[model samples]
Target: MKVLALLLASLAAVSAQTEPWCRCAAFVTYEHSEIMVFEAPEVTIDSCTDDAKQCKNSCTKELNDFSNNGNLWLVQENGLTVGQNICTYMADHFFYFIHNHRVYGYFEVCGGAWEYTGVASQQLLCCNGGKHEHCISK
Candidate 1:
Protein backbone atom coordinates (compact mmCIF):
# COMPACT_ATOMS: atom_id res chain seq x y z
CA MET A 1 0.00 0.00 0.00
CA LYS A 2 2.81 2.41 0.78
CA VAL A 3 4.34 1.70 -2.59
CA LEU A 4 1.02 2.43 -4.24
CA ALA A 5 0.78 5.71 -2.38
CA LEU A 6 4.26 6.70 -3.48
CA LEU A 7 3.48 5.89 -7.08
CA LEU A 8 0.35 8.01 -7.01
CA ALA A 9 2.24 10.92 -5.53
CA SER A 10 4.91 10.70 -8.18
CA LEU A 11 2.32 10.71 -10.92
CA ALA A 12 0.69 13.79 -9.53
CA ALA A 13 3.99 15.62 -9.53
CA VAL A 14 4.78 14.62 -13.09
CA SER A 15 1.37 15.63 -14.32
CA ALA A 16 1.75 18.98 -12.69
CA GLN A 17 5.01 19.66 -14.47
CA THR A 18 3.71 18.42 -17.79
CA GLU A 19 1.33 21.34 -18.23
CA PRO A 20 1.77 23.54 -21.31
CA TRP A 21 4.11 26.50 -21.11
CA CYS A 22 3.53 28.18 -24.43
CA ARG A 23 0.94 28.23 -27.17
CA CYS A 24 0.40 29.72 -30.65
CA ALA A 25 -2.69 29.30 -32.75
CA ALA A 26 -2.84 30.00 -36.46
CA PHE A 27 -5.96 31.90 -37.40
CA VAL A 28 -7.13 32.47 -40.94
CA THR A 29 -9.74 35.11 -40.42
CA TYR A 30 -9.66 36.03 -44.09
CA GLU A 31 -9.68 32.53 -45.51
CA HIS A 32 -11.02 29.76 -43.29
CA SER A 33 -11.62 31.78 -40.16
CA GLU A 34 -10.33 28.77 -38.26
CA ILE A 35 -7.78 28.69 -35.50
CA MET A 36 -5.08 26.05 -35.37
CA VAL A 37 -3.76 25.88 -31.86
CA PHE A 38 -0.30 24.75 -30.81
CA GLU A 39 1.21 24.42 -27.39
CA ALA A 40 4.34 23.00 -25.80
CA PRO A 41 4.24 20.34 -23.11
CA GLU A 42 4.55 21.44 -19.54
CA VAL A 43 8.10 22.40 -18.58
CA THR A 44 9.91 24.59 -16.14
CA ILE A 45 9.86 28.33 -16.61
CA ASP A 46 13.38 28.26 -18.10
CA SER A 47 12.59 25.55 -20.62
CA CYS A 48 9.30 27.25 -21.37
CA THR A 49 11.21 30.36 -22.40
CA ASP A 50 13.38 28.39 -24.78
CA ASP A 51 10.45 26.48 -26.23
CA ALA A 52 8.43 29.66 -26.65
CA LYS A 53 11.26 31.21 -28.61
CA GLN A 54 11.63 28.09 -30.76
CA CYS A 55 7.90 27.90 -31.49
CA LYS A 56 7.80 31.52 -32.51
CA ASN A 57 10.74 31.06 -34.83
CA SER A 58 9.44 27.84 -36.38
CA CYS A 59 5.83 28.97 -36.81
CA THR A 60 6.82 32.28 -38.34
CA LYS A 61 9.19 30.60 -40.76
CA GLU A 62 6.59 28.06 -41.77
CA LEU A 63 4.02 30.75 -42.48
CA ASN A 64 6.49 32.77 -44.50
CA ASP A 65 7.46 29.75 -46.57
CA PHE A 66 3.90 28.58 -47.05
CA SER A 67 2.61 32.00 -48.08
CA ASN A 68 5.76 33.40 -49.69
CA ASN A 69 5.21 36.39 -47.48
CA GLY A 70 8.06 38.50 -46.23
CA ASN A 71 10.02 37.15 -43.30
CA LEU A 72 8.06 37.45 -40.06
CA TRP A 73 10.28 37.13 -37.05
CA LEU A 74 9.66 37.36 -33.30
CA VAL A 75 12.56 39.10 -31.70
CA GLN A 76 12.85 37.88 -28.10
CA GLU A 77 13.66 41.22 -26.59
CA ASN A 78 13.17 39.79 -23.09
CA GLY A 79 13.77 36.21 -22.05
CA LEU A 80 10.52 35.71 -20.17
CA THR A 81 8.42 32.67 -19.35
CA VAL A 82 5.36 31.41 -17.40
CA GLY A 83 4.64 32.79 -13.93
CA GLN A 84 6.28 36.01 -14.95
CA ASN A 85 3.89 38.86 -14.37
CA ILE A 86 5.26 40.96 -17.18
CA CYS A 87 3.92 40.10 -20.63
CA THR A 88 6.78 39.43 -23.02
CA TYR A 89 6.26 40.95 -26.45
CA MET A 90 7.39 39.51 -29.72
CA ALA A 91 7.71 41.25 -33.09
CA ASP A 92 4.32 42.78 -32.31
CA HIS A 93 2.52 39.60 -33.34
CA PHE A 94 2.87 37.13 -30.48
CA PHE A 95 2.76 37.61 -26.74
CA TYR A 96 3.80 35.43 -23.78
CA PHE A 97 1.40 33.13 -21.93
CA ILE A 98 1.64 30.42 -19.30
CA HIS A 99 0.12 26.95 -18.73
CA ASN A 100 -1.61 26.31 -22.03
CA HIS A 101 -1.36 23.13 -24.14
CA ARG A 102 -3.05 21.75 -27.24
CA VAL A 103 -3.31 18.17 -28.54
CA TYR A 104 -3.82 15.43 -26.00
CA GLY A 105 -0.93 13.20 -24.88
CA TYR A 106 1.65 15.35 -26.66
CA PHE A 107 4.75 16.78 -25.15
CA GLU A 108 5.24 19.56 -27.68
CA VAL A 109 3.18 21.75 -29.99
CA CYS A 110 4.07 24.20 -32.78
CA GLY A 111 2.41 25.64 -35.89
CA GLY A 112 2.02 28.71 -38.12
CA ALA A 113 -0.31 30.66 -40.43
CA TRP A 114 -0.38 33.77 -42.59
CA GLU A 115 -2.55 36.07 -40.51
CA TYR A 116 -2.87 39.65 -41.62
CA THR A 117 -4.75 42.70 -40.47
CA GLY A 118 -5.75 45.52 -42.78
CA VAL A 119 -3.08 47.50 -40.98
CA ALA A 120 -0.32 45.08 -41.89
CA SER A 121 1.19 47.92 -43.87
CA GLN A 122 1.28 49.90 -40.66
CA GLN A 123 1.90 47.20 -38.06
CA LEU A 124 3.20 43.70 -37.62
CA LEU A 125 0.63 40.90 -37.40
CA CYS A 126 1.39 38.75 -34.37
CA CYS A 127 0.19 36.20 -31.80
CA ASN A 128 -0.43 36.84 -28.14
CA GLY A 129 -3.05 34.53 -26.67
CA GLY A 130 -5.06 36.31 -29.41
CA LYS A 131 -3.93 38.13 -32.54
CA HIS A 132 -2.40 41.55 -32.16
CA GLU A 133 -1.32 43.57 -35.16
CA HIS A 134 0.46 46.70 -34.15
CA CYS A 135 3.82 48.41 -33.98
CA ILE A 136 5.90 47.94 -30.85
CA SER A 137 5.10 50.82 -28.61
CA LYS A 138 8.08 52.97 -27.78
Candidate 2:
Protein backbone atom coordinates (compact mmCIF):
# COMPACT_ATOMS: atom_id res chain seq x y z
CA MET A 1 0.00 0.00 0.00
CA LYS A 2 2.80 2.44 0.86
CA VAL A 3 4.60 1.69 -2.39
CA LEU A 4 1.41 2.21 -4.37
CA ALA A 5 0.69 5.55 -2.68
CA LEU A 6 4.22 6.79 -3.24
CA LEU A 7 4.11 5.82 -6.88
CA LEU A 8 0.80 7.60 -7.34
CA ALA A 9 2.08 10.74 -5.67
CA SER A 10 5.20 10.74 -7.75
CA LEU A 11 3.17 10.27 -10.87
CA ALA A 12 0.94 13.18 -9.97
CA ALA A 13 3.97 15.37 -9.36
CA VAL A 14 5.48 14.37 -12.68
CA SER A 15 2.23 15.12 -14.44
CA ALA A 16 2.46 18.85 -13.82
CA GLN A 17 5.37 20.39 -15.77
CA THR A 18 7.34 22.59 -13.35
CA GLU A 19 10.40 23.86 -15.12
CA PRO A 20 11.73 27.24 -16.29
CA TRP A 21 8.95 29.11 -14.47
CA CYS A 22 8.47 29.82 -10.80
CA ARG A 23 6.00 31.90 -8.79
CA CYS A 24 6.55 35.68 -8.78
CA ALA A 25 6.29 38.02 -5.85
CA ALA A 26 3.81 40.89 -5.81
CA PHE A 27 4.69 43.68 -8.27
CA VAL A 28 2.88 46.99 -8.61
CA THR A 29 1.77 48.76 -11.76
CA TYR A 30 2.37 52.48 -12.04
CA GLU A 31 1.16 53.74 -15.37
CA HIS A 32 -1.37 52.26 -17.75
CA SER A 33 -0.50 52.68 -21.44
CA GLU A 34 -3.13 51.68 -23.92
CA ILE A 35 -2.15 50.73 -27.46
CA MET A 36 -3.75 53.08 -29.86
CA VAL A 37 -2.83 53.60 -33.51
CA PHE A 38 0.59 52.14 -34.07
CA GLU A 39 3.36 54.30 -35.58
CA ALA A 40 1.66 57.31 -34.05
CA PRO A 41 1.57 58.83 -30.56
CA GLU A 42 -1.74 57.35 -29.50
CA VAL A 43 -0.96 56.03 -26.05
CA THR A 44 -3.46 57.05 -23.42
CA ILE A 45 -2.64 56.93 -19.76
CA ASP A 46 -5.49 54.97 -18.29
CA SER A 47 -4.32 55.47 -14.76
CA CYS A 48 -1.40 56.44 -12.56
CA THR A 49 -0.83 56.31 -8.83
CA ASP A 50 1.29 58.66 -6.81
CA ASP A 51 2.94 55.84 -4.97
CA ALA A 52 3.96 53.89 -8.05
CA LYS A 53 5.03 56.96 -10.04
CA GLN A 54 8.74 56.55 -9.44
CA CYS A 55 8.67 52.83 -9.93
CA LYS A 56 6.94 53.26 -13.25
CA ASN A 57 9.51 55.80 -14.34
CA SER A 58 12.35 53.51 -13.35
CA CYS A 59 10.72 50.52 -15.04
CA THR A 60 10.21 52.49 -18.23
CA LYS A 61 13.82 53.57 -18.25
CA GLU A 62 14.95 50.02 -17.65
CA LEU A 63 12.75 48.74 -20.44
CA ASN A 64 13.95 51.36 -22.90
CA ASP A 65 17.55 50.49 -22.02
CA PHE A 66 16.72 46.83 -22.40
CA SER A 67 15.06 47.12 -25.81
CA ASN A 68 15.80 48.59 -29.25
CA ASN A 69 15.15 52.18 -30.41
CA GLY A 70 13.28 52.65 -27.11
CA ASN A 71 10.94 49.96 -28.37
CA LEU A 72 11.04 47.41 -25.59
CA TRP A 73 8.20 48.77 -23.52
CA LEU A 74 7.28 47.21 -20.21
CA VAL A 75 3.57 47.86 -20.47
CA GLN A 76 2.28 46.79 -23.83
CA GLU A 77 0.01 49.46 -25.35
CA ASN A 78 -2.79 46.97 -24.72
CA GLY A 79 -5.15 48.89 -22.43
CA LEU A 80 -3.48 47.93 -19.18
CA THR A 81 -4.79 49.86 -16.18
CA VAL A 82 -2.49 51.21 -13.53
CA GLY A 83 -2.15 49.66 -10.03
CA GLN A 84 -2.88 46.18 -11.39
CA ASN A 85 -0.97 43.06 -10.47
CA ILE A 86 1.31 41.97 -13.29
CA CYS A 87 4.12 39.41 -13.40
CA THR A 88 7.36 39.46 -15.38
CA TYR A 89 8.53 36.75 -17.80
CA MET A 90 12.05 36.20 -19.09
CA ALA A 91 12.47 34.75 -22.59
CA ASP A 92 16.08 34.25 -23.62
CA HIS A 93 17.38 37.37 -21.87
CA PHE A 94 14.21 39.28 -22.69
CA PHE A 95 11.02 39.18 -20.61
CA TYR A 96 7.88 39.41 -22.72
CA PHE A 97 4.19 40.04 -22.23
CA ILE A 98 1.35 41.54 -24.24
CA HIS A 99 0.16 43.78 -21.45
CA ASN A 100 -1.48 40.73 -19.93
CA HIS A 101 -1.94 40.48 -16.19
CA ARG A 102 -3.93 37.29 -15.88
CA VAL A 103 -2.07 34.11 -14.98
CA TYR A 104 -3.65 31.81 -17.56
CA GLY A 105 -3.59 34.47 -20.27
CA TYR A 106 0.20 34.18 -20.42
CA PHE A 107 0.40 31.36 -22.97
CA GLU A 108 3.54 32.44 -24.81
CA VAL A 109 5.54 33.11 -21.67
CA CYS A 110 3.96 30.49 -19.44
CA GLY A 111 7.03 28.30 -19.14
CA GLY A 112 9.33 31.25 -18.72
CA ALA A 113 10.85 33.02 -15.75
CA TRP A 114 7.80 33.79 -13.54
CA GLU A 115 4.21 32.65 -13.15
CA TYR A 116 1.46 34.66 -11.48
CA THR A 117 -1.11 33.20 -9.11
CA GLY A 118 -4.87 33.03 -9.67
CA VAL A 119 -6.96 34.88 -12.28
CA ALA A 120 -8.56 38.28 -12.89
CA SER A 121 -7.22 41.73 -13.78
CA GLN A 122 -9.06 43.26 -10.85
CA GLN A 123 -6.40 41.87 -8.58
CA LEU A 124 -3.81 44.55 -7.89
CA LEU A 125 -0.55 44.35 -5.92
CA CYS A 126 0.99 46.85 -3.56
CA CYS A 127 4.55 47.73 -2.64
CA ASN A 128 5.75 48.83 0.79
CA GLY A 129 2.18 48.75 2.00
CA GLY A 130 1.07 51.04 -0.83
CA LYS A 131 3.86 53.56 -0.49
CA HIS A 132 5.56 51.80 -3.44
CA GLU A 133 8.90 53.46 -2.81
CA HIS A 134 10.64 50.08 -2.88
CA CYS A 135 8.87 48.71 -5.94
CA ILE A 136 11.95 48.89 -8.13
CA SER A 137 14.64 46.28 -9.00
CA LYS A 138 12.27 43.40 -8.30
* lDDT by candidate, in order shown: 0.34, 0.29
Q: Model 2, residue 100: displacement in angstroms?
A: 27
lDDT of 2 at 69: 23
Question: Which residue pairs come into collision in candidate 2?
Answer: 35-77
RMSD of each: 15.7, 17.7
Q: lDDT of candidate 2?
A: 0.29
Model 1 regions lying over 4 Å from their true place: 1-8, 12-25, 30-34, 37-46, 70-138
How well does candidate 2 score on lDDT at residue 42? 17
TM-score of each: 0.29, 0.20
User: What lDDT is reached at residue 105 by model 2?
Assistant: 13
Write down the worst ten-residue block by lDDT for model 1: 98-107
- lDDT per residue (tens digit) for residues 7-44 in model 1: 99999997876533434233322334333233223233
102: Cα error in model 2, Å = 26
Local accuracy of candidate 2 as per-residue lDDT tens digits, 52-132:
333333334332332222222233445332321122222222333333221121111222332222222332232232221
Minimum summed lDDT over a 10-residue window in model 2 is located at 34-43
